[model samples]
Target: MAWALGANSNSPPFAPAIGANAISTMRAAFLIGIFAAAGALTQGGAISETVGADLIGGVTITPLAASTGLLVAASFMIFGVYSGYPVPAAFATTGALVGVGLSLGGDPAFGTYQRIGTFWLLVPPMSGGLAYVTATLLRREEVPETVGVPLLAAVVGAILANIRLGVIPHPERAQGSLAEAASFAVGRPLVAGVDVVAILATVVVAAVGFRYIRAKTQVSAEQGIRTFLLILGSVVAFSSGGSQVGLATGPLENLYSVELGLPSIILLGIGALGILAGAWMGAPRLLQATSREYAQLGARRSIAALVPGFIIAQVAIALGIPISFNNIIISGVIGGGLAAGSAGVSRRKIGVTLAFWVITLVMSIAIGFGLYRLLSTVLGIQ
Candidate 1:
């Protein structure tokens, strides 16, 4: 999402705060590493789990194959991020995984493919339309601040409350609602009378307590809207992490599951580390590529991009589909650009990026399939 990029973006004011020397560069690297690690733990882990479990149903990945796939995909992602190009990691990795898996005796899950393709195709137009509408509404003079802000807050609260949660790769084992989790922790059944009582108690406390405090502050409606947007952006970032890392680590599913002698958690940890490293060492360039190349963005524009990106990424994660962060962000950028008007963005740059996306997917699939076939023949694999 745009805010994810914006948050990591070195603002103009911060540019002069650090020098561009070896020591400074080293320090930057250090910070990048830390940020990347955090990114990996969240995004990488989610991505890996999706790739491993959903790519081919009813068959566990082999160690050699998984490692081969992961190494290849991750290398390309790092290359793109470092070279200041937005490599659609999800496109490349997912295509590669399908190529490799199909060549290795896996059947194509046509339904899954269709679902993923639908989301991928839908995002650009949907995001653009939503951004246009949101921008228009915000520009309106008659929309009341009190009503508008609370409505936004309710929307954000609904999204946060419904996000899937449980152990990775096991949707059925979900922790259920936040209220359910709390009730379960206290030895009460989620559907029992006790649970209902506890839920009411918590709701009363949160609503009354928050309302009392908010009334005391008497904050302006604009302030409330800003707060809601901020909260929404944060949730979106967390979801983005869950989705983007899959491209980084999905290829390694076999190694983590077999050779590494690990479960989903352990594999997720390893993938997370790789993502963290990538984010720290390689994330900034891609961030720059997006921020500078897409459109000139203020805070509101940035938030618009991020919200949709986050939503799409989380959806991909849930479906066990691989996706490109670059594409997702671009969809948002295009949406924001449309809202701003036709002349506000670079048509040439958009064309180039689109070309690259097409080429990347085609090339990655061809190479992956070819490599899998060659390897299988050389190894006498069945």
Candidate 2:
């Protein structure tokens, strides 16, 4: 599953950078693997919890259930790889889990479903709208390239200050953010549930980020732009690892952590390795695909696409939501492409991809339910 995911995800974040000739293909793939591993280790826990524990109720997930669910989900994703449509990994896994849970007589987790479903629905429009607006801003003649580009860097820096991570000083040793550490040092000042110190810290970081990007731009506009694209691609690639690893490791979360009395970090580490291997072994071909397909869009639109991808990815991680990077990236691509007018975008391709997403979700549910029931009966394990 991780291998399939790596192949499926290879195109979105780094491809545009490759398309823009910002970095070599092999180097981008190498960095993607390493950063993805880092993200999985640091930020994969919340999503693992959501997938393994919160999606189903009234029954514990047995080893058999885990195997069954993962089998169904992984099979669907591998099929997607050969078929050439990027399957929604989160949706496939979530549906398969739901199916196996039902087969085990677990009740539906309606609240989790509601929250996840709502977010899933909003992804297309929200990502699209943000990318559209961002692309438009970058193209505006009134806004200088230095100011506009640096402003984006500053926003990302502000967000980075608040991105939750599996780190020190978090309650239960689970998670905390850079902003939280800043607030901790300042006697825990808070106003309207916002950390005053954190805000100041984010402001300082944003200023630094803006200044650095601006300086880079002033030296050589084109090179600075390409360099920033490389950096942005790396950031989004890291976010993809954080967001995507859960789909592969989610089913094993309970089996490895609770049944074996092991730590969740160990489970996340296992998933991280799978992702690393997958990225290294399988990412080049798809990266080449995008090198051809995405080059025509140019750098600014690609930047617009990736900025929303980074923002939405972090938001999903903070909320403990299982997300498909494909959905967010494609939506952003479409939105960003539209900024250049209709010629750059494809309507039929969008329609086909959208249909496939729905089909993947529904089919995974049915297959998972049937497969689990058959496997359980045959093995007498449940």
Q: Which number leads on lDDT?
A: 2
Candidate 1 all-Cα RMSD: 6.5
Per-residue lDDT of 128-208 in model 2, one digit per residue for the tens? 889889999999999988989999999988988888777646654567788878888778788988878988989998898
What's the lDDT for residue 106 in model 1? 82
Q: Give the distance in Å from residue 370's predicted Cα in candidate 1 to where it truly belongs.
A: 1.6
Q: Model 1, 289-321: lDDT tens per residue?
A: 565666765434444555566566666766666
TM-score of each: 0.74, 0.94
Candidate 2: deviation at residue 7, Å?
2.6
In candidate 2, the residue pairs with backbone N, CA or C atoms under 3 Å apart (3 or more residues apart, or in different chains) clash, namely: none
The alpha-carbon lDDT assigned to residue 207 of candidate 1 equals 57
TM-score of candidate 2 versus the correct structure, residues matched by position: 0.94
